[model samples]
Target: MGTDNRIQTIEESTVYGLYHHGELIYVGCTTLALKRRLCFHRSDASKGNDAPIYGYIRKHVDAPKEDLEIRALDYDTEAAALQDLGHKTLNAQAADGAEYEGYDWTSEEIDVLEEESLNEASKRLDASFNQCRRAAMKLGLIDGDGAYTRVDWSVWDEALGTMSDPKLAEKIGCSVANVNERRRAKGIEAYQSRLSDDKVRAIWTRYHALEEATYASVAECFNVSKGTVARIIRKETYQDVERPPRITIEVAKRYHAQKDKSTDKGRILA
Candidate 1:
């Protein structure tokens, strides 16, 4: 895994260090953006990779990522930092012959996108709900008596317990806080997906039989992405699971509706 004893540098390469409580613990160089590189480290750490940095993060999983500071250094400083930090820095070796890569997007960017989306949604709702209501009435999206656009609360009932507030909001085109408020109001618990063989079969069964059981809704129900549900339905994955026989959509709908109602009742009672 060693390069030809030559340090490789990208056109806009960055040398960065990971610090814990003001002490440097890791050193590396990347052609990628700083945040993007950190995101990759975080992903690898979550996947239980064998790297020392990953092990450190896994051991301190309860601590917020901010506690592990990422600070950029001058291009010429990689060797000095690695030497100064010695074995305490989690580098296998210095940047000699190291290859760095760049990416256009990272998980951190996705989180920023979600937060920005929620902020924009809240702003629109606060500033223009009444105005949009009038516009919607003229466009006939709502009747005259409706002063504001009302979400079909029934549609969200099935989704509340299955997915996180952010996911539910993204799926239903609302703010995370708004989805959270509605869920808490009804005494629904937060989303925590529990996947297993039995759960996979249940997801497949419902999607195949229920007309209202869309990939998005079913994914929400199982706390997975819509793509995951689609892959399961299309047999791209989970090929060993036995496919259940198709049933009437009406019967499926009735069963699901009753199940959701019962689940909601249980939550409220609890």
Candidate 2:
């Protein structure tokens, strides 16, 4: 019964060709089989017509042997098998042609696979966001006033740390625009204060040539719209009108005289 089962399995199995150095070394396939392909490769006699495959195996026997790995192609679909085969062919070509040397060649292949994986992951993320938005709408998380639940700043911080704006906004039960508006509002006071201080210092530090640093230039540095920058400069509370408190010769003389009189009075009292 076991022998009959093994024969039945082999008759129904699908095999793939393995290539080495761009040469077809073996032609075989598998189903839910008893032995792995690598196991066959390791034990098979390298005589007669299988001389080339045997020679290839012999060349690697003494060298540091890399493990043979199998990846599942779509088991029952021709298109899936072809796609996986193409990827495998490219990887094998790269490996045999010294395209990958010294480093982990398998890791490079896996990196390529990971990039393809991310595309699906990104699509799923977007789909999840849409589902959440719909559910939130049903739950009355969004009111008739067009205002959704206010995103906690802490949630925003965590979301920003891990996810993109659209994803974060969806997770936080708000629109992307609302998220941005909240972020700006949260920092507006500090941003405005910094800009105001920077503008005042710019004018003060370059008092000799205040025209050199224009409102437009400062605006660019602060990343605000040019019109906003112009408004900031125009409404700047600290102006160039009050020059730094000056120490004139007359004032200095008066101050010295006062100091001398005070010292003389103290000495006399002592």
Estimate the TM-score of every prediction: 0.34, 0.24
lDDT over C-alpha atoms for residue 176 of model 1: 63
Across 1-270, the per-residue lDDT of candidate 2 in tens digits comes to: 233332232234444555554443444434422124444455553342255455556664442124333333334533344445644442222111101111111232333323423223235443343333332232233421223445567645523424455555656645666765654444332222334545444433332233356666655665655655553445433332233333443454466568779999999999
Count of clashes in candidate 1? 2
| Stretches > 4 Å off in candidate 1 | 1-10, 75-77, 97-270
Error of 2 at 16 (Å): 62
RMSD of 2: 21.4
lDDT of 1 by residue, 140-220 (tens): 333333111246878877677577777777667554666877766664545664255577778887787666679999988
For model 1 the TM-score comes to: 0.34
Compared with the true structure, all predictions reach lDDT values of 0.61, 0.42
Report the number of clashing residue pairs per model.
Answer: 2, 4
